[model samples]
Every structure is written in structure tokens, then in C-alpha cells.
Target: MATPGTAKRMWALDSPTFTVDKSLLLLGASGECTIPMPAFLIEHPKGLVLFDTGLVPAAATDPEGVYGPLAEHLGLSFLPEQTVDAQLEALGYKLSDIKYVIASHTHFDHTGGLYLFPDAQFYVGEGDMRFGFWPDPAGAGFFRQADIEPLRGRNVLEVPGVDHDVFGDGSVVILFTPGHTPGELSLLVRLPGRNFILTGDTVHLRDALTTIAPMPHDADTVQSLRSIRRLNLLRDSADATIWISHDPEDWAEFKHAPNCFE
Candidate 1:
């Protein structure tokens, strides 16, 4: 094994913001909440890897252009500069530089930019891909046929129902975390000094971890709860920092782009 921290550098890309009823994210929660949509860029000795891709750049000017029928329901407010392409450019990198694109799931927001990295190797959960083909009606809106349609003829690796170590070095791993959808996956990054587990909507809010609150749209509430507990155990047993990718509070604290976590 290449020891921990085999990945050299990592950055959280800037992303557009979106608002939704708090109840949509957490069960029994009230009020509306605006949360940042973020994608992460990591540099491994192997090459550049992106965790998610945020929303489409065009969505900045036309939310409808991105969300279509779901635009108004989303209440998204995106800025031109918040696009992943722009943020990568600002950081002296470009979409083509990324060698690997790991989709947390087929959710439009998370895999929005997959088309940008056509040449890059793509990794996703088999279940998510299957869901894309046959989505649970409850979570159907979360998907965009266009988001995944582009994978056609491209090199894509569908991870099975277990954790996958991307580099075989114990540095960057893809955790099989489903339930939110049928195949939502999470990420694990091991730095020399510390480790991190980025929960990609495993539980949208940190509080859900303690509350054991459920997302009404989850395909399987029981499975979702199991996944949440799995995350908790992973965090404790691995002594890793758990980051809820969509939580507004998490967004505020994260060092975006020009700054990064090494």
C-alpha cells in the first residue's frame, strides 16, 4: 500500500447555490434552506479526480435551462462564476485535466458536468446506473436523463455493492452508500495527517446524523438509515472527518478552490 495521503492535493470547487424546503432534505425539519452545490477537485499522483460536478454552467443565467420542469421548484440562484469550469480555470486547471470523474450518484446536480470530461475514466455505482434506467418514482425528479445520457460510448466503471479503493493505495476510496437514491455513493480521502469521509447526501445535514432523520424521498428508509449509521461507524472507526457535502454550514466552513486541503 502507498501509505495514507497518497493523493497530493485537493480543492473544493466553487458552485452555484440552490434553495429548497428544509423538509425536503430532512424529515420533520421546517422552513426553507439555501445550500451550496459543490464539487471537489483532488490531485493524486495518478492524476486529477473530481468528486462531483455541480450544476451546469448555463444554469447561472437560466435555471430553467438546467432544471427544466423543476426550475421554480428548486428556487436555484446560480452565478456565472460559480460554474465548475470557471472555478477550475481560476485554479489553473481545466476540465480536461481531470483524469477520473466519480459520480456520487446519477443526481443531476452531482453528475451535471460529466459530459465535460468525456475522456476521463468515470466511476459510479452499479445500482445508481441501474436506477437511472429504472428510477424509484419517489426520487425520479432528482435525476436528469440528459445528465447520464452522455455516458454512452464512454469508459465508465460501475462499482459494485462495496467500497472501492480508487488507487489501490488506501488513499482515495469510493464508499457504496445507497438508499437516498438507489445507489448514492460517498467518498473517502486519506491524508497523511488525517482522513475525511465526504458524505454525498448520505445525510444532507449533519444533524440528521444525530436525529436519525429520514429523507422522505429516499427509495428505502430502512436502507438509508443503515447507510447513515454506516457512515457514523466509518467516521469513528477510521477517525475521519465527515463532511456533509450539501449542508450550508459545511459550505461556509470549507476552503474553496484557490485554497485546498492537502
Candidate 2:
């Protein structure tokens, strides 16, 4: 059970803007190709939880090794100064202090910094781990072995169904939302005075959620829409604030590092 009156706090770690052409790739129809990617930090009574690990500094400097072809495809030229570790340190928290990490999915961008938090228990969807560790490197959803190698044999909480209560007391819950990837998931945190839902990539932008638009590269467009609807339902039920991982508008609206949710 969660501690009574537990205050939930969140911080924006990285806020990097990119062109839509570079982000959505084949999905941009209007040539309005620009978007922003933001990562979040959550503080709970149970422990410090990081929603998605943003791009590591190494990846930006050595794009060839970390980003591979994706960088070229997206036309990425620079990286953000605030890495996950640096941002956490700024808040007086170290990587080791983050006891748990919930990754919405294992895509390169989301999982790039997993190695940095080696001590944190990882929480991911069951199908995501399978998709990430597929034997075939050519597979559509395969993840780099280097990124996940350190997590081997560590504590991994795999959600089997569409939704799971992480702390029993409802302080934290992991929502399984497939579409962007086979097992993409979201996070919902119940705070002292508010609630929050971390939408991994279910709806990259607020526009997508309002219009219920599906991204072109999703595994299943229909499933993605269903997931979005589920998020809407949760939002209404909990009166929660929805945080889209890559929406620049949402990032701009939220307070940045050193300022937390609580």
C-alpha cells in the first residue's frame, strides 16, 4: 500500500525540439515536420522513478555507433545538454537513488540511457522484452544488445495484461498500450493532490490524441487508437494530467528541472 498523503513530484529532464520531418518520418503529410522530445522524472514515496531515459550524451557525440541509420533518416544534428544522470543530480538525486525505472518501450531513444541506472529495477511490458531481445537483428522491433546487456538478470517487472497496479496502493500503475511497439506501455502516478499519466508514444502530440490520429509506423493503427481511448478513459476517471513523451507543447507548459510535481 502507498503511504498516506504521499506527494508525487515530476520534473522535465530534457526538452529537445526537432522537425516533424525528422521525427514522424513517413507520417508527416502536411510537410509540417517538427516536434519536441521531452523526458520526465517522477518522485514517489516508494522511491524515485524515471519514466523514460532520454538520449545519452555519448549517442549524440557518436551518432554512428548509437543512433545508427535513424539519425541520418531523422536529420538530427545536435543533442541536449541535460542528460538523464545530470538532470537527476541537479535535483539532488543520483542515478542509484532511482530505485525503479519504467520504460514505455525499448525503442532506441527511450532505452538509450538504461545502462546509466544499473541499480534500478526495470519495469517493462512482457511483450516488449521479447520484441527487444529477438534473435534476428533485422527484425522490425529489435533492440541493441549493448543497451540491454547490463539489465540481464536484474529485477524486471513485466506487466502481463493491459493494466497493472505497481504498488497495490494505487500510488503507481503501468498501463500496457500496444501499437507504437508490440508492448509499449504508459505510467500513471497518484500523488498527494493530483494524478498523472505518462503517455509513452501512444499519442506523440496532443493533436494526435484530440484527432485520434495514428502514427504511420505503428505495429497496429487500430490498436493504437484503442490505446489512446484507454488513456482518455483513465484520464477522465482519475482526473489526471496526461504527459506526452514527445510533445513540445506539453513540455513548454510544464516546469523544468529543479522544479518538481509535488
- Taken over the whole model, the C-alpha lDDT of each candidate is 0.85, 0.74
User: What RMSD, rounded to one decimal, does every model reach?
Assistant: 1.5, 3.0
User: Which candidate's lDDT is highest?
Assistant: 1
User: What TM-score, to 2 decimals, does candidate 1 have?
Assistant: 0.95
lDDT of model number 1: 0.85
Question: Candidate 2 clashing pairs?
Answer: 9-262, 10-261, 19-33, 19-34, 20-33, 20-34, 21-33
Give the best candidate by TM-score.
1
lDDT of 2 by residue, 128-208 (tens): 777777733434533565676667888888878668876666778889988777788998877777788889888887877
The positional error of residue 175 in candidate 2, measured at the CA in angstroms, is: 1.1
Error (Å) of candidate 1 at residue 150 is 0.5
Report the error of model 2 at residue 170, Å.
1.4
Candidate 1, 166-197: lDDT as tens digits: 99888899999888877789999887666789
Q: List the lowest-lDDT window of 10 residues for candidate 2.
A: 20-29
